[model samples]
Target: MLRITAGKLANALRGTVSGTSRVAAVRCLHGTEESAEEFDKRYEKYFSREGIDGWEIRKGMNDLLGMDLVPSPKIIEAGLRAARRVNDIALAIRWLEGCKDKCGDHQATLYPFLLEKISPTLKELGVPTIEELGYDKPELALKSVYDL
Candidate 1:
């Protein structure tokens, strides 16, 4: 298996790869010809710095491809907290949206928390629930409800 740096993996996710070349490289290094032990060693080396970000992407890909492994709740919670800290409402919404599939047990718990934060603004705009407004068109929804 070919060893890859965490920074290289992160950069690839951020569009640094530009095309199929990086995929080809990774495949050549760790694909069918590589043994499971070699792949595990190479992956561990990359996971050191990429950390949760790397794991999250791996989980997402698994979900997309219908693989069975799920991400840990801790990672989801940390992502939600980070989104909240940054005041990134859309990101927070997406985090919650994505969690719906993997964290069904905690979905009810998150609703009240989200409602508490956005309720006032939602009410002021006469929107009853987040489901009533198109997240992509929040401004338009607010304007329609409030005649703004």
Candidate 2:
């Protein structure tokens, strides 16, 4: 369950190894032929002050979707955390929407917990709950896979 991107993993390894060594380690560990220069550039951007933002998380999720990979709860959670860290409610809800749409019934088990995590932010922003967003049922707000 290596849920994070290679660049993130590489950046984490930087505490133990130099950046160049980390890049080499990642390359060797993953058996990737990507050039050191490319990895360096990618990691530099990835480890910047902003780190990985919600947009990048969305793009990564989209890339996985484009590859026909169904997102697991961990993937969805990562995107949600990124969206929340960036204070992007629209992106948070977009990830929620993706969970509903792409994850089907499997998403139900996570909704209550996810809602608990995001509810404060929603409240702070004065955003309406899914029920107020035109959903007819409370359970549907947590468990429904279809958009309201």
Candidate 3:
């Protein structure tokens, strides 16, 4: 049996790997990074479009929340409004939770800022936050049998 350290393997393959990565990197860079404001506007426009259905709303939210960065308050506001227009109260609430989670370590500041900015829309749309509805904890979180 033969075992090669990753360092030795990389040194052996570096020439080919580096050559391939350069072309791949150039192709990847074809898409430019959008500004935060542009990002917010793009998503806001997506959710505010006419005839947007519940499935589309959920898909858009999934894509936005799945991004590396948390969405802006305006984008969230627009999404919640779309969910309300589609008559999906649960989706609205869940997106709120999703935004909160995306706050990452900045929750102390970012989440509250989001709530404050989006509160008026929340009230207008009749959507209560997950915390306000007291559902952050699992309803069936019982003690494990082994714990006894």
Candidate 4:
């Protein structure tokens, strides 16, 4: 799990720095940096009733990305590769799909690199032509080609 600092969360959410001051105080009182699980629990307790927007969640993830608290790109790539190598084509496809969802325009640039690694396995999967995959239309293609 990713551990994020309260200040980082505040900055990412564009919330008042003082919003996380209480959380920071709690951490200090506990004599240890709070773990992500603790922060998530507090977030639910403090914010679940407040009706926060999806943008806030996006911001928090962005902050985590900026702080390198989220999984590294190399780690993600390696996992994708491993999934393909292990003949877990569904897992590899989901991994790439997630990359496209999270990275957006940047995904196009990254896709070629990932494709170089997994295209053969993808072909073996017998669904989702490369063209469909590149266009982010894997499901339709998969259903048509593989009847799945």
Q: What's model 4's lDDT at 80?
A: 42
**39-84: candidate 3 lDDT, tens digit per residue:** 6788899999999999999999998776666888899999999999
RMSD of 3: 7.6
Please write out the lDDT profile of model 4 over residues 64-145, one tens digit for every residue: 3333133334444444444544455565555555544555466667656656655565565543533665754545553456
Whole-model Cα lDDT of every candidate shown, in order: 0.47, 0.57, 0.85, 0.50
- Please write out the lDDT profile of model 2 over residues 98-124, one tens digit for every residue: 645554475566655656665665666
Q: Listing every candidate in turn, what is its Cα RMSD in Å to the true structure after a full C-alpha superposition?
A: 13.7, 14.2, 7.6, 14.9
- What are the models' TM-scores? 0.28, 0.40, 0.72, 0.32
Candidates 1 and 4 compared: the better one by lDDT is 4
**Best model number under lDDT:** 3
When sorted by TM-score, best at the front, the candidate numbers are 3, 2, 4, 1
lDDT (Cα, 0-100) at 120 in candidate 1: 58
Clashes of each: 0, 0, 0, 0
Model 1 RMSD in Å is: 13.7
| Candidate 2 worst ten-residue window by lDDT | 40-49
lDDT of model 3 at residue 29?
Answer: 52
Worst 10 residues of 4 by lDDT: 63-72
